[model samples]
Target: MKRESSLKRATTETDVSLALNIDGSGIARISTGVGFFDHMLTLFTKHGKFDLNIEASGDKADNHHAIEDIGILLGKAFYEALGDKAGINRYAFQFTPMDEALCRTCVDISGRGYLVFDVPLTREFIGDFETELLEEFFVAFTANSKMTLHIASLYGTNNHHIVEGIFKSLGRTLKTACAIEAGNTEIPSTKGIIE
Candidate 1:
């Protein structure tokens, strides 16, 4: 069976449509009107080996709302795709490096939403993408996905590389955590249920 989900959200601030395939060949089709964000999402998809498609539009004032809403939808799609979470690894972590920057991302699909983001970005923006929105995206995603996510920038100077490493680590981590384990047919939890 294909592990996939899709969703669409419309609010006063933005409108976002997203589709995700947890088991895929790393194909991405993204258009958020934020070039740098598009690049980040593309790389993320490629690293995770997940197919993702996103189309979003936000207010003319800024693109923050669109990205955050995308996070919300993306998280929902993942939750829906995982279903009962049977046989999934359920926990994973990754350390990714881009140039001189390194980031660590960890995740646990315990159906309890939490986030611990500690990336220090000095730059206010990466191209047209605001650095502040990076945390917002993860925050929104973690909350909506009902997962525990911890991201830490071990070291980084270049803002672009720092952000890239974070997203890449996140992608790789989730990819591992969502994988189905061989010969394991039950949920990977002692509680008998994730929630």
Candidate 2:
């Protein structure tokens, strides 16, 4: 059986489609109106070693809604694909650095939506994409996936590097957290369930 889920979402402002594999080699095919954001997501999937396919088109008037909605859809796909969340590692963390920027990301599929963002920067826009939209995306992803996510950019000068490091780190951490543990047929938590 394919341990994967395929999903699509549509609104007046955006049309999004996604295919996700919980376990696979890093490979991605992605497109969005915003080039840089698409690059980031591709890098995230590539470095995290996930097989992902995404396509989205949004209103030219605003990229925020499209970007954030994609996150929500992707997160929902993850939860649906994972089913009962049994026999999974359940937690993961990674610290990644890009040029002068360093970021740490940690995640837990705890059935509670929470995002702790610590990126402190003055600028709200990264090229054509809004930096604030990154937070919005993560928030939507967390809520839909019912996962607790923590992302921190401890130090960075360039916005590009900071954001890139965070996404890549998040990808790696998530890949680690979702791996199946050998000889373990139950959830990874002591509470007998992740949810």
Candidate 3:
């Protein structure tokens, strides 16, 4: 069974379309107009071993509209794909090291949207992507995916390395959490339901 979702959200503001697959080989076709953002997202897909495609257009004058809209679209897709959250691992954690940086990430696919992000960048921006946008990405992802996420950069000197560690860590964690467990059709939570 292949689960997928497509969403379009528009005001006078922006238009975004996002589609995702929970069980897929790593493949990505992304266009967000923000080059660095696209790169990070591509890494996200590749590392997470997910197939994802996104096309978004918004007021370039304000990156906020485009960024937030993508979040909304992705959230909707995750919620749709997990429908009832049966037979999933439901929880995962990872600690990844990228050269000098180390990041730890944990997630619970419990139909709850909560995020704990802790990474203080030595610089305000990396390329055109603001350092703070990392937070926005997780906030949006958790909210849309209806999952609890915790990300922390335990040690890193370079801002780029730090952020890269976080994304890679998250990707690996999600990859594990979403894996299908054979012969298990119940929510992994002890409560019988993830909600």
Candidate 4:
């Protein structure tokens, strides 16, 4: 069975919907009023080889609600799609470089959601998307997806490059972590369950 999920959320601040496929050919169709965020999502989907589609609308221009909500919905989709996490590798890491920037991302689908973000951004905003919200996005994602994620930027001078590298590295790491192991049809934990 193909691992897939579709989810939606509506609030006074935003309304967002998402669809995800863990085993796919890197196809993405995303729109949220935030252009920079859309670009980042596209890169993540492409690198992860995950099929994702998102549509969001609301008070996205003046605040952080839209981006955060998208992260929440996406994370929920992932959790729903992965269901039981049997046979998954469950742990992976990757390092990606963009121009003069480099970032490392590590993930464990341990059913314990936590995030360790240690990145430095050279600017406050990258095309209207606040740089600090990058952490917020990942925080929401990690908590909802029930995974432990650690992202660190070893070095970076350009804010865009650093952020791009982070997303790309995260995508690659998740791709591996979610992969199925050959002849290992069991949950990755010693307890015989992931959650």
Candidate 5:
């Protein structure tokens, strides 16, 4: 069976359509109006080796709505694609470095939703994207995806590099966490059922 999902969400603030294929070559076609955000999502798809397609539009004067909504839709797609979460690794952690920046990400594909983000930046904006919106995106994603996710920028001087490291680490961690373990036909939980 193909582990894939597609979702569409429209609200007063934004409109988003997204698709995800968990087992796929790294291929992305994304357009969210915010160029920097698009770059980050592209990197996320590429590093995770996940096929992703997203088209989003919103109040461009304020990017927060669009960014957060995209995360929600993407997370919903992941949740749908994962299905029963059986035979999966379920937990993964990774540390990624980009130039002078380093980020660590840990993911648990639990049925509960939670997020711990620790990214400290001195700047407020990265081009057209607001730096603070990153946390909002992750919060929405975690809430919708029902995953426990932790992301921390251990050290970084440049905002761009820090964000990039976070995204890359997130991608790698999610990729490992979602992988099916060989010959494992049961959920990776002690309670017999993950959900």
Candidate 6:
């Protein structure tokens, strides 16, 4: 069974489409109006070894709607792709470093939605992208995917490196969490069900 999903969301503020394949070589084709966001997503797909395609358009006067909606659609895709969450690891964590930045990320495919983001980014913006919107993206994703996600930037000075590390770590952690473990044919919860 292929773990894949395609999703679309259309609202007055934004229109977005996304496709995800959990099991694939790292490949990405993303075109969002936000350049920095597109870069981050590209790195995420490459690090996670996942195939992803995203096409998004929104009111460029303010990128908030577009960024959040993309996160929502991406999360929905993951949730749909996972199905019953059977025969999977269900939990994963990773610590990634880039230059002067280090970030740790943890993911749980629990039927609950939660996010704990702790990043001390001193800068307000990275080029055209507002740094604060990164949290919004993760929050939207966690809510829609019903995932327990924790991301912490242990130490960083450069805002770019810090955020990059976070995304990379998240990608690696997600890959591990979604992997199908050998000889584990049951849901990874003691209660015989996940979510």
User: How does each model score on TM-score?
Assistant: 0.98, 0.95, 0.95, 0.97, 0.98, 0.98
lDDT of 2 by residue, 36-116 (tens): 898899888988788889999998888888998899988998888777777887888999999999999999988888999
Q: For candidate 1, give the lDDT of residue 34.
A: 97
lDDT of 1 at 12: 86
Candidate 3 TM-score versus the reference: 0.95
Better of 3 and 5 by TM-score: 5
Compute the lDDT for candidate 2: 0.87
User: Going through the candidates in order, what is the number of backbone clashes in each?
Assistant: 0, 0, 1, 0, 0, 0
lDDT of 1 by residue, 1-195 (tens): 678998999998898999999999999999999999999999899999999999999999887889899999999999988989999999999999899998999999999999999989999989999999998999999999999999999998899999989888888999999999988889988899986
TM-score of 4: 0.97
lDDT, residue 15, model 4: 91
* Each prediction's whole-model lDDT (CA): 0.93, 0.87, 0.83, 0.91, 0.93, 0.93
What tens-digit string does per-residue lDDT give for candidate 4 at 81-148?
99999899999999899999999999999999999999977788899788888999999999999999
Model 1 weakest lDDT span, ten residues long: 59-68
Native-referenced Cα lDDT, model 5: 0.93
Model 3 ranges with Cα > 4 A deviation: none
lDDT of 3 by residue, 39-131 (tens): 878888899988889998888575777887787788778888877778878899999998999999999998889999888787877888877
For residue 73, give model 3's deviation from the true position in Å: 1.5
Q: Could you tell me how far off, in angstroms, the CA of residue 189 lies in candidate 6 after the best superposition?
A: 1.0
Give the RMSD in angstroms, all C-alphas superposed, for model 2.
Answer: 1.3
Model 5: residue 29 alpha-carbon error in angstroms: 0.4
Give the distance in Å from residue 151's predicted Cα in candidate 6 to where it truly belongs: 0.4
Sliding window of 10 residues with minimal summed lDDT for model 4: 57-66
lDDT per residue, candidate 6, 133-188, as tens digits?
Answer: 99999999999999999999999899999999988999999999999998778998
- Name model 6 segments beyond 4 Å from true: none
